[model samples]
Target chain A: MSVIEIKNLTRDYGGKGVFDLTLSVESGETFGFLGPNGAGKTTAIRHLTGFLKPQKGSCAVNGLDCWAESPKIHGSLGYLPGEIAFFDDMTGLDFLNFIAEYRRVKDKTRMRSLLERFELDARGKIKKMSKGMKQKVGITAAFMHDPAALILDEPTSGLDPLMQSRFIELILEENKRGKTILMSSHMFEEVERTCRRVAIIKNGRLATVDSIDKLKAAQVKKYVITLENEKAALAFAKEFAEEDVSETRVTVSIAGNIRELISQMNKYPVAGISMPGQSLEEIFMQYYGGNKNV
Target chain B: MFNATLFKSGIKGGIKTLALFCAVLTMYYLIIVQMFDPALGKMVQELAAAMPELMAIFGMNLNSATLTGFLASYLYGFIIIMFPMIFSILSVNRLIVRHVDGGSLVFLVAAPIKRRDVAFTQMTVILSGLLALTLYVSVLGIVASEISFPGELETGKFILLNLGALALHMFIAGICFLSACIFNETKYSVGIGAGIPVLGFIIQMLSNSGEKLEGFKYATFFSLFSTDGLIAMRPNAVWGMVALFFCAIALFISAIAVFTKKDLHI
Candidate 1:
């Protein structure tokens, strides 16, 4: 059964809110919500979390209607807001304890584990904590309950790369334990790493919803082939359609056609080989019409 | 429906401001209670008769020689009325408007408590704080007066005065709380939250300008309680209290309804 369901949830904020959006996350499946800023990512999550009531349709969590049965569903779900707004005078420890108390968790084992895993000391006043530290506090509060489902809005935002990777590892570990997770993020790499299926929202509309494997399979991989000399590279470039036909370098972009390229490359005197840094942007670009809203 | 945790935090967060206002009121109330003299009251009456406009602005009655009249005109008239209105406005703004604007309310609602519960808890906190402040200051003032000058201060009249002040604050707090629930942005929320009470204070002041505008007192939320009138149990005082009670309940209902259904798209 689906742990989360949003059907035709529309809340018009001057033609900017989510419109006719329909999506669902199966129990134990980590679903990723991908979208640019102001693209209704946070708005949709708010409805699922029951912070915002839908004007048009419905969002449900754990088979309970979101708007009608909000408090009931919140007991089984954990949520992190896009921006952490902590009490001005409280320490991180105080904030975590308050949330734990509210959620009625008896054992502090999970809270302690989350704190240690995130490397958060949680002793200083939140007002004094750095943005990354505050984000760590938010992450800790959201996961400490060990709820059956979690909704995180740009959860990895504001963390350093090391912390971001740790967060991805944590999500993977939690998802392995059969927790239903729905996370919204503009960071494609993090989404690719942790999510099984992803839905892309652009300008308050769903652009695409597909499995990560299929999306990755459909991505264009670029290989920059360097020949022994400019003459060979030029001749090789002529035989094959390429991006940059320089003196000794020819860049090939294709969707999983490395076998065809390998046959064509063998006929030339290959000098060096390299691929530029990889990005999910290459495939996501088509949805945005080359506007790289990243 | 109220969540214990949210209500506790609401009271906890408001204690500092509430205490500060209470301390200031306590010190001033005690000082004046100690300073109360029959001779001073007579002198104040003479001054008020000479400058009726100045006296009316403070809601001063002509009978200033009595202990009840002295406190009513001197304390309850302007400072007492102004302070509680400010406290109510500030408390609601902090407890509701600020949290909503800052997006911290999302965290509270993100808990098992529904949005309605969160709003209810906040309403309870604001109401409780104002009630506590009224009770504490009244008790402290009476205690200080009894210790300093036994049987000199009118206890019955003072209690009546406090009730009137409490009712007025109840109504003012409702307006501020309702304002907090109506708007989402900090600027607009706090603007209305603070604006309404401040406007009432101004109207109350203007109504005291002369007899021609005395009827305008009914237009202000603060008119529910006049310390002098409450002590005397005037006919209008009963109607004022009744009016405030109904308006407060209606505003409270609207506040909860609006907050429960408002779009918190954080």
Candidate 2:
């Protein structure tokens, strides 16, 4: 059984909404939602969380209609918004108690553990807390309930690197306990660590949905090399196909010949050699494009 | 059904504003009732007889000897309506639109409940605050009257007067809450929320000036609670109260319906 399901959900807000997007996460499966900003990741999550009513299709959770039965459907679901805003007047503890009581969860052992694991102090007022601290509070609120299913949008957006890894562990732990989670993020590493199946969306549409192992296997690396002269650049460019070659600089793409490419490039008088992180779009181009070349 | 947790949280959030209104309005109600010495009342009535238009803007009747007319004009006229309207505008807008704009509303509706229930709970909190304000006026009016001038105020007519005022503010609260639900941005919600009441005050003031401006009275929601009917202690203005009740219910229902169907950017 799928814990979260979105089918052809469509809402066109001028130029900023999801269109006919459909996806689902099976029970106990950690599904990674990968997309750039304004790619409708949050919009699709909003639909699953029942914050938005679908325009063309339907969103269901645990076999219940999300729009009409949001109250019942989301009762056992934990939702962490991408941009979190708490009641400014209350302390973090107060907000947590407020949510706990709101959810009617009596036992708070999990809430305390979540707070300790996140290294958060629930004493200070939320308005005075930093953005990162507020995000932690949001995470605590989402995880403390011990929900059956969790829907998180950019869950690690403001956490530090250490905390991000800790969050990945938290998700993995919950996954072991048979909890379903659908997380949206921009970081491939985190998604790679915890999410088994990942979905990529672009321009309000699903670009691709595949397993993490498959995507990582198809990943390509781009290297930029600034040579000593045009002669060296041309010699290096001759070995590799045309990427971008100037008089003294050459950019190259390496798929599976990193060792060979490095050895070949070292023969030249290299001034600067650098590799840039591939964005989601670039990764998609390489992940899908590089396979055809093989 | 209402969410108890949300209802409790809402009341806590609203208590400070509710207390401020109750304190300020209670003091004003006490002072206005205390100032009603017969000699001064005669003097004000005589003075008002000279420039009726000036006193009319404040909604004060010229023929003012009884305590009911005195309290109606001075207490129930201008600042009384203004303060509660301010509370309604701020609180309702804060509860609904600001929650969406600030992104806190995501927590409430995301709970295991219907969107309409969230809307209903917040509306209940707002209406309950408005009810507190009206009830304070009624209870304190009776207690204050006993302390200051016994038998001077007809208790029956006083209750009718307050019921009329409650109906008016309920109607006002509904319109403000509707604005809060319609607009996602706080500024737009507040713009319409505050604008409607201030506009009503202006129109009511103009209408109270004379017959030529009476048409403008109908333009404002305040016209449903006639100052003349309130001062005259006519308990039979059933149509006016009925209109106010229906308008309030209609606007409130529309707000809930819009909220459940509307897409939130959260």
Candidate 3:
């Protein structure tokens, strides 16, 4: 069952286009939306959450159109916006209480547990909270309803490594409870560690959607080979058409055929061999085409 | 239920607002007490006689131009325009600006609720807050008037007249709230919201002193609850003011419509 179905969505604001895009997430599946900064990740999430209306085409959550049936669809989904903004005047506890009222749910025990898990101070005013703390509040609010599906945009933003790890743990726990999750992040490891499938969005368009295993298998492989002797380097070059051929070491880029290439390369007296896995930044460049730091 | 929720928050916001208003008024009162000079009194008497029409525009009785009347004159002008403008701005800010600035609008909009429900709730808060503040000022203005000028005027009618004036301010405040919905940016919303009331004040000035612009009162919020019209017991002007109040309500509803359908992200 499709938890979310976005068909040719295009949203633009102030001349910055969140262009024609199409994607889907299946029920009980953890899908990763991979993109660099300003790659329309947040815009796409906003449209899904009904905070925005598509400039063209349709988007739905569980067959309910986002624009037409936001109220109903929203009830079945948990959403965490990219930038968490809170009412400063309200205490954290009061804010969550108000949110509970808005979500039409009461689970004080669960709410408390979430606060404790996030290590959040419920007594402090939201204005006084650190950025990471505010993000925790946003995360807690999204999960408090225990909705069937969670749409998280930059969910790990502003969290320290420990908290990020804890968040990953929580997400896995939620997934185990049969909750469908679509998490957008620039962190490859975060998605690689948690998501079964990943959707790479570039220029507000779907670049690729494949299982993590398949993505890893299809991922570009970079290998540096150092020749034992100058004679072996020439033979190695002759054996295979190489790239970035340097003085002692030569770096080669290969795709899914790295194993075959490596077997062929072993024909030469290779002094050193190293294969580096693709980073999130490398994959983002392969899809988005711009200068971005992971 | 919406009303109940609105009333609670609106009252909370309103109380904070009323405190600010009272503090300013108290400071003005003390200044007036300190500045009550005989030369200033005579000057005010001459000025009042010379401009009976202007006195009415400032919510002062032209017939009574003594020291007390002179002082009340300043207080009346302050409360009728400046004080109310500030009140309207802050109250509107409390509804829309506060939410946008605090990022609470994000949380509110994220819920499985109609956008109209969220906007209407804020509208309810604005209306309730304005009403409470108007009532408080009405009572306070009357008591202060009585203490300043013992046995000189009909304090209740004056209070009622002040209530009518405050009602007009509230009407504009309501428009300010609606304007907040029309504009997405908080600064723009607050600017236009605050600007419209000030424009109304300028129009009130034009209506009074600008002989060619006296007819502009029809557009200014000041004419909606003309204290002079109320004092002279002009039912037509009062009813016209009532019509303007209804117009504000229409604007308020339009705001709800726009907000519900329009895409909002903050």
Q: B121-230 in candidate 2: lDDT tens per residue?
A: 99999999988888988888888988888888878877877888888888899988888888888888888878878887988898888889888877876877875686
For residues A143-179, could you state the per-residue lDDT of candidate 1 as single tens digits?
8888899999999989999999999999999999999
- TM-score computed on alpha carbons, candidate 2: 0.91
What does candidate 3's lDDT look like per residue over B1-266, in tens digits?
Answer: 25344346556657876777777766765565455554565666677678867765665555234444444456655464677667778877877777765556777777777777888887777676566666766565555555655554566556556656656766787778777878878778888878887887877765776457767857765666655555555786578567767877887888788777777765
Q: Positional deviation of A273 in candidate 2, in angstroms?
A: 8.5
Candidate order (DockQ): 2, 1, 3
Give the TM-score ranking, best first: 2, 1, 3
TM-score of each: 0.90, 0.91, 0.83
CAPRI docking class of candidate 1: medium
Interface RMSD of each: 1.3, 1.1, 2.3
Per-model CA lDDT versus the true structure: 0.84, 0.85, 0.74
lDDT of 2 at B143: 87
- Top candidate on TM-score is 2
Off by over 4 Å in 2: A223-252, A257-275, B210-212, B235-238
Residue-level lDDT tens digits of model 1 in B72-94: 77788887878888898888878
TM-score of chain B of each: 0.93, 0.94, 0.78
